[model samples]
Target: MSDNYAASFSINQPGRDAGILPVNQPGRDTSTSEQSHTEPSANGGSTVSTRENVRPGVSYLAGRLEFEPSIASKLDALITEFRDGKSTKGNTVFEAYDFVNSFPGGTPETRKFALSEFLSTIDSVEILADAARRCGDRAQIGLNHADTTATPRIEYTANAPNDNALIQAASQIGSKRARSEALSDADVGPGRENDMDYRSGEKRAKLTTADLPWHSEALAARQDGRVSCQATQDLLYRYERDPGWVRRQVIISGVAPPTIPPGEWDAIFRGTPVNLDAVFSSVHHVLPPKEDVGRVGSTEIRFSNPEPSKRIQTANDWTTAWDDVSEATAIAFPHRARELKEYGSYIRSEFSAKMPSSHRKIILYDIAIRNFVQGGQRHLLTDFHLFSRFHSAIVAPDGVVSGSGSGTKPGSSSRGRAGGRKIDGSKSEVCHRFNDVGRTCPFSTASCRYIHSCKGCGSTGHGQRDCVQSGRDSRSTS
Candidate 1:
């Protein structure tokens, strides 16, 4: 503290130490002197001073320094005196800025920090503009300046304005006097405003669907069945074919059903009721024989013709055509499972009717497989090869085709039990003769001589309890 300010302020010369001049020191300029300095010459010949003009306490090399008290201390003294009514007027931002500029010899870094503090503490824009003109880097200093910088930095303090305070500020911005007043005085704290409360679009409230007058009319139309969901769906369908017509019917009229063409009315209403009889007939190709078809539950056998065109037909001619082609294909290729798309295409070609969707075809396939399994536990056919052969044999007028993948064709009575014998833990010389019939081992030399084989793939290397391939094979065999 022993003249640290003076020692810090003076630049290093040849011999003269930067001496401390105490406030009480007599015969020395202490009233904030500027312009020139009388110092003993470096060569000790006479008093020397800088030719370039130097401000009060600042010079090019040495920055401004504390005298008896620092600039901060002096500002604090002025503030306290003004608060106590000892000064002629209140401490204003202009006064604080003037006090800072008076000391023109301070370091650039020190001056910036001091100027930032003054700008932050003062609320007046005029004072801030003046400071910006005098400062070296106006943008840099302005960015760091904040009204709360004067407050002591501490832990866990809210430093932004809250929502209520911001609302109050926006409300008061209309008045000049209110704009001039401090945000803190307007009860605005120094914390951020919650974004949820500060939406920046048109200030008017948003309207919901229920707020529209037409909403009630639309609801009434629907409740009275004057506006059918089917009609709306038909409009969507027509949108794919004739978009302009659909737009006139739907968009122009606000989806009113009366806007639709008269030609489309009968089809829309007729398509609403599903033709379950035709659906059952198209899917019947996959069902078990007549006696075993009853085991399939009605709930498990759900089918729907997603295509609107098919649902419009009343003659059930499409089902009869599909049955003929499917039965013909089964008889000709008894060793192959029928392809859904191929069967669908043939029906469309012969009858010139649009086929059901792939989704509907898949549903039909699922129903067939499920019913085939539901016929009997021993009669389950999981292999595609066996399923095709068994289907062809059933539909074949002459007993020409059989359900065997190899020689020694099993008869119709034995065909159902063939799948059972494969999994029934019984051994036969024909099954054991090849030695590789059911062995799952990677090596071809591995043999299956045991009585028990896997219920899944008929493999003998692993039992059903430990087999991994068993479950996978069960899903795709038939």
Candidate 2:
């Protein structure tokens, strides 16, 4: 069985009290000047003392309880034994040492608990010295061996209390103390030479390194272009095997296309051009005829050509010309055109939802502007403008008109209503004053311009069902 040992203890200065003293009066000596300065002499006589001669010991243990709870519980038993007069010694270091050593393995955790309990009765330094003496006695056989390597690993075995789990808990407690005052491995217990297997049967605890934050930061530095990807990967693998490397590789692959020999480009682009013209012609033949002037409402109404020319006359015009041809062909074709339009609209709506609103608006605006410039139609631009104006009116401060008029300034009457609404019974007053003026009072009318109002009461004064005065009147009548 593996040996179990908990961390040891170190003395530190206790926390200071934060309470403030009462204010001193003008004649009061707040300073230590008027106080008696005397010290108790070794011979039990008074001696002259100064502030410089005074030194204070730690008032509280500035450390954590190092033992597991189970081992610490045993201290209560010892305390009971002491109270019952069954304990052999009284208020001595040897008594604590003997009590702790009685455990099957005087593991560090058990020792620490014993020290804490002993200090509750005696002093910390004395308890620590006693523990060291006890450890020295147990390890005495191997102490004088000239072969420094020949040391038996003490195996802690007992079921009454287990300290194994906490013994391997990382060194944060010991590291918090100053290096000089820190507990050494020797203070805990001698490490096992033959007891190599340290695996615990309890749930396996994850081992986290102290420098994890630094490692993550280093990887981020590489991602942000401070270092090469290969360098980052190497650094990461040095600490732990991470699956994130695969994701990083995929991202790098996407951003940078793999290099291909110049000879491959010609072969790739040599394929025959798609017969877009034939496709458009076939679509035009199968489509319904354009609407007649009488059918749509005016004799002067002329439908523009449903199919644009497909051939690209200039390099700059190719993309625009191709797009127009494709669009016109789709509009002319009946079944396929309707299906394509619906599918395209669905895709655009989904993409718009996923994209930021600002980005979506910019894209929509660009498409509308392009359609207008191409002499396609004016109604699309008109719709775009209306939508943009409505969106701005809802979001922009100046776009929001406060009054019935379209002017940007907040109306004087609106401000008056807002101020008057705070007064009791002002709802009836405002309604009588404004009802005939074609401006409904925000207080009493259902057609009130103010958005925040109680729908049930038809008044801005208070909610109908929760009215306190109404409830009181009902109770009185009952």
Candidate 3:
């Protein structure tokens, strides 16, 4: 009859509980008389609890688990230490668990299938630490991951033509038959086809006439003289005593020098023969004197005794006979005929006695026939002889006038005989007939189109100094 349910049967009474219910304790007295039993809340409270099934945890089953039996048994012992290709110290704990299962959210699908299963397990770590230091003690402690075989195959062959036919029949039966009997007892030929006589003892001492003691005095001095200057100084002192014989007589007689005939200067000044008509009348008395003298016909001349002489005829004998006597004295002194034929080729080449008597020979034949007739044409004396001797230097009878030199006064002006007057104060007689024809400036007159539109900014026809649309609109509105 001790009925005090010590504050709700003290945790379902498992020990210090010797007595307790009696009010008809039948099924906890009919479940505490059907209803009311509330006294246990001082923070140690629980009424009938046992819940705990909340799963989705290890961070939600760590991305749906699987190959993690400790990283699939350290990737099956690092794919069996790379299929037994050795190196172990737990292969850096299987490469730090294969670089933390190659991250980006470790495995499942992210670590690109665990970095392609850890790069198909090895073929590197320096070839598995050089196959574990050359696989000492047959190293492979485990990793027959179901031995799927595949990697070891090598094999090569080829060099067999019966091992090069038994090394070419044992080098043709040993030491190549003693190097073919020491090259057939040293006659060593058969290969570069013979002929290396290397002067077979000086070409067998040049074959005859008592072995060459001057081959019978050079065959009796080539029968008297077609060659004798003492047999060409004993064949040029035996061709300079032989060795390479003056480069084989300068490669067989072609070294060059012999030409000779420019009229052989009369057989080179006749060391004794003279009289070819007394050497052409002593060189035609030192030459220059042949004036207008007549004939015009013959030319023969030849001589150094090869003959042909008799035809001198004369007038102007030929080779442009002093250019036909200076073109017939420049057609008969038409104004000192090219100063007397350039003073006859400068006194026939004694260069007019070395010039300066005010360079006379008629002033070097009037400056060598006025540089041989104004070299590029035009100057055959013009301006109607100073208007036929000055009719006030013929002012505008259609202008022209010219002359002023060799003894002046043909209408004055090379600045002399009180010359100055002409500028005809312009009534456009074409600017006073272009200043009486010495034309200084009617600027080619069709009234000089305002002097040809003022030649651009010396102002008129508008050359806005290279305008460019007034300089890009004055640089875009300044």
Candidate 4:
């Protein structure tokens, strides 16, 4: 099965039909917004959107649990605090419902325990704060967890020790040793075969080739006039910090590029003109010591040799097999020819790695030439991630993903394409149907997860319907 980021962990993909908004991978970026829905009605009574919007009580936080009248009263109080708890716990209270709903479901007894434990935890430790960061970063436990139901009657999941995922994730933040810590000289050289920082420098530095500030500086120098020495220096420094990232980006950024004449590759990829060291990698291993030059069965006797042996080298030092990645980049993005000319040699090596040159050549060439979708929609380079486990997902002649391919579902890409009110919440993509034309989505509020915006400007506050920008139709944009 393809172990895409979310599927790699056994956690289910949480939906947000639960009267709450959604957050991206809320483990790192803690930004979230709180919103309430109310609409002017056709008959003047008023129309309401968003599901399960029951205010358990008037949102009065009592001095204690006050559960004698019924669990319902207690529930109302909790939900009240939860929904209106913004600014109480700082980040988490800001997240409100999403933070509470992130908990997985459990049995009645376990759930009951979960309810009290959750409240107790909230009343005590800073679990909420950490959880908000975790949700923003990883474990996208949006809203509709399999274990929870509507509020008042709402429940939290507690399946014994196995279910404190967000809690565990919260505790783990800033806990790992920074990648730059304690590396011997030999460990800091070129080639990044083992590094795997998916955040791409959004968080830690294991796979970050350089600090964001340095990238900012580099970006300022990204123009055509940047000197060759500067580019070399940048690439080398990135290699020194996170050699694997440079290589990874090389493979990642170029895929299924627009086709061209087959022979066009010959100029840059063929023969020995392009160096192997620029594309492939090598490993140096010290062999075991050899015995003295005397046969064991012969009359001559020899003692075991203890001297150190020579270090053998295995290298993918030559090949005319694959297209020259630099040339490919130059051809694909002609506008960036200057940048490619500067950084292409060091950057393009990522695609080759340790794989056989012939395989590399055949594979790259085959994918490049193949028809993409079922109806022949061409594959764009951005649509492909070569290193993802999902890359081999079976697709029919049409663009549809095959159900038979484990972990690769049809149209999986569209589920979160735009952000969500259902899944991404207030961070959802704008609702152009409502904003641009004063028409709500055909699928109503809960079913349609887009932002509610001013009809004219598509922004909040009194934006003009006439203010809607031209050529920016969110309804048909995707």
Candidate 5:
């Protein structure tokens, strides 16, 4: 309430409080009476008056208004009337400005809040003016405020324009004048030559965009779209960024500090605030999100704005994810890299051949990726059927798969079951594992369903490991 408008607001003072920012107070002059930033006397000392620290009131918004300046000067008179218990008589600027100033202004945060609310009011006023013009109401429209502020501050009461006795008296005077002159419908001679309605004549053609002001360069640039958006991103690389000392301090404190809930604010005011200076530094190595499905009942995952860093990039491409992965893979592993290539091909064929975008199937593909093309879970040679000739390839030659991280152990007998007594193929069919014994493979003990029997003449007693048949009895393993 003093002429100093709170001496704690040491705005524009350099040494002790130079680092304190102006918050959202744009275009404001804040040279303190304590120090002169601009002019100096011959004695090398300040000549700044007490007026330097004096509050500008509505004059603070003079050149700094974000909207029309028409009603700006009227604000001083109106708000003065409001503060001194005089009537504003339903002027909007007074009520709104008083409401804004009614907020506590000791802290930069509260001042910033007041500025933001003021700007919002100005914007609403602009929008209202536009609507008023559109509705053929030429009177300059002001803010029709929501009553969160002014009504509580004063004994505010609504009085309609029709309720004023002066307005009724004015209307009566106008009616008497109309009767005296009988104008707007005066008697004239019947023979009138001039056409009163210019619209009744040959109509003018409606104008196209060609008739209006158009910037061709801007239009061309929009169509071309090679220009970068140049939108500034908050990467939290804040310190050591600003050239000015004040801005750097603002970064350390905060610029537009996050709006807190009422309870949180109360707690903050009561308790000590944690001044921890963001210990963790940001790194470039980022992982894909752990869970892509952000919400329940929605299979499609939507991209959200990345926090901590406001970096945003957008693109539309025709190629699928499979194509991109495949392209990267070939560069990492060449064509001769049989294992990786086989795995890639298998995954593509199973899930993304026609590129069916089923998320569940992609999950299955991820499971299969853990196992390679040479991952050994092959069928035992004892259980070999029509598929034996197909298995005789590079990855695993024998039925015992090397490095088989699976249910079957390597080099365990398919026939070496039932407490180690080898049962020949007297009761059961021939073991396919025995079929490959002498020629191509040595028998490895892996679990098999078929019995160890001879391929020739189905004899289990004579040929257990080797088939002695030479003439007219050698049959194929297939």
Candidate 6:
């Protein structure tokens, strides 16, 4: 009999579906034994069982938690009240619903909804007859039913916390400082790289070197044939000392020379040069001291406060003050070149320390002038002192300088004007004035009756507008 039973239990592939019993076989009874289903467990064990009908449970719990409640306390209270007195073991169908609710998962609202759903749908809870305790002396308070109707009427929710909220909460705990302010308070003492301002200052100084006004003036003067070696040295010295005076004397009048090259005949016919030293001496016995003629970083000079006598005490105070002015000016340029007006507004807001308006204007002008020069616009030097005024003057592409007031005189290179003189050999003229080569005269009307003399010339001038003699020479007698 044991051998027959062994033959019936034939081994097959693990997890293979149960095969149907054969209907007929040679010399065998067809319908003597009952058919059974065998299922393999993960531990290589197999269990034989018959099928039973089951009902599926509906999902109720979903979403986030809002309120906090003690699940352990509720579970203990339900277990104690719903138990039989004999062994304190046994729970009612309603107690099973409470047990499921007390189990962890889902928001407060979701759990309450699930409990209501379970109480309404569940008909009865049965403690199974085959239910047995494997371990002795162990306290078991819940229902001992093994199957519970072969399926659960209410499902337990698998709730997970929001990942984004968890990540955000983690990030907020230990934030870092901005990179610009990375220098620690310890690293910044009285003047030791204080608040990383030193880094910024160092960068500004390097940048200022490339765009200094004095450097621009030097290059322009060098191209226009004005600067000498000794003049350059004196210029540098003055820039290091009194930059304000250099501006008063020179860069304000630095206009670019004409771009076109003169023809050989045009050059030869111009003229002999005049003795300017003698002429200047005759005009004024004492020459204005040969001044520094560059503005390269000279915009840094801050004028001293108006003294009763209009002078400063020690040279040291003056030098220190000028250095401060230059440093501030350098900070504002090239970096803020495009947004100069905005930068000026920012400066006003930051200067609660009450900086002089003149100093602020000086720095702003430095930025503006550099921007103009870089944009390929010519700087038309106008006399600020003569006008005692404040205004911007437009320079035409043709190099005509026009302004609002009469006090602003555009310099001529002919009659010892602030721009100095250029000799023209074309018309036997000792003086060649600064003329816009192709520009119309700003003063001329359609018909002029005034004695129209050429600039710096007593003779009928070279151009058609002024030289009536040349006009007559060109006329035919026929």
Q: Estimate each model's TM-score.
A: 0.16, 0.15, 0.11, 0.21, 0.16, 0.14
Q: lDDT of model 2 at residue 333?
A: 24
Worst 10 residues of 5 by lDDT: 228-237
RMSD of each: 28.8, 34.2, 48.7, 36.6, 28.1, 30.4
Top candidate on lDDT is 1
Q: lDDT per prediction?
A: 0.33, 0.32, 0.28, 0.32, 0.30, 0.28
Which stretches of model 1 miss by more than 4 angstroms? 1-70, 77-91, 120-478
lDDT of 3 by residue, 201-318 (tens): 2212223233557766655654553321233333333333332334333335543111211122222222111122222332334443222223335433442343323212121221
**Candidate 2 TM-score to native:** 0.15
Q: Write the per-residue lDDT of candidate 5 for residues 203-258, one digit (tens) a residue.
A: 24323223445645534544554211110011111211221332224335543132
> Candidate 3 local accuracy as lDDT?
0.28
lDDT by residue for model 2 (1-478), tens: 0144432322222243323222222232323221213334354433322122112221111122333334444554554344333454344335555656665654555554445435443322222222233233221222222124322322222333535333332222223222212122332211221121221112343233322557556445545642223332333232123223332343255432122111111111221122333333333343433323223442233333234333222222223323433353232222234433443454345335532322223233333333332221112222343455543543233445212121113434432233344222111123333323223444423223233333333454543333354343222332
| Runs off by more than 4 Å, candidate 5 | 1-57, 60-433, 436-440, 447-478
Candidate 6, 372-435: lDDT as tens digits? 3231112211222322222133221121222211112346222332123322211111222222
Position 469, candidate 2: lDDT: 40
Q: Give the TM-score of candidate 1.
A: 0.16
Q: Please identify model 6 stretches exceeding 4 Å from their true place.
A: 1-185, 189-413, 416-466, 469-471, 474-478
Give the local distance difference test score of model 4. Answer: 0.32
For candidate 1, write residues 340-400 as lDDT tens digits. Answer: 3444553344333312211222233333443453312122223354455433443222323
lDDT of 1: 0.33
Between candidates 1 and 2, the one scoring higher on lDDT is: 1
- Ranking of all predicted structures according to lDDT, beginning with the best and ending with the worst: 1, 4, 2, 5, 3, 6
Give the deviation of candidate 2 from the true structure as CA RMSD: 34.2
Candidate 4's residue-wise lDDT over 314-405, tens digit each? 21222221234445534433443554344333223533542321223323322332223111112223333442323333322121332232
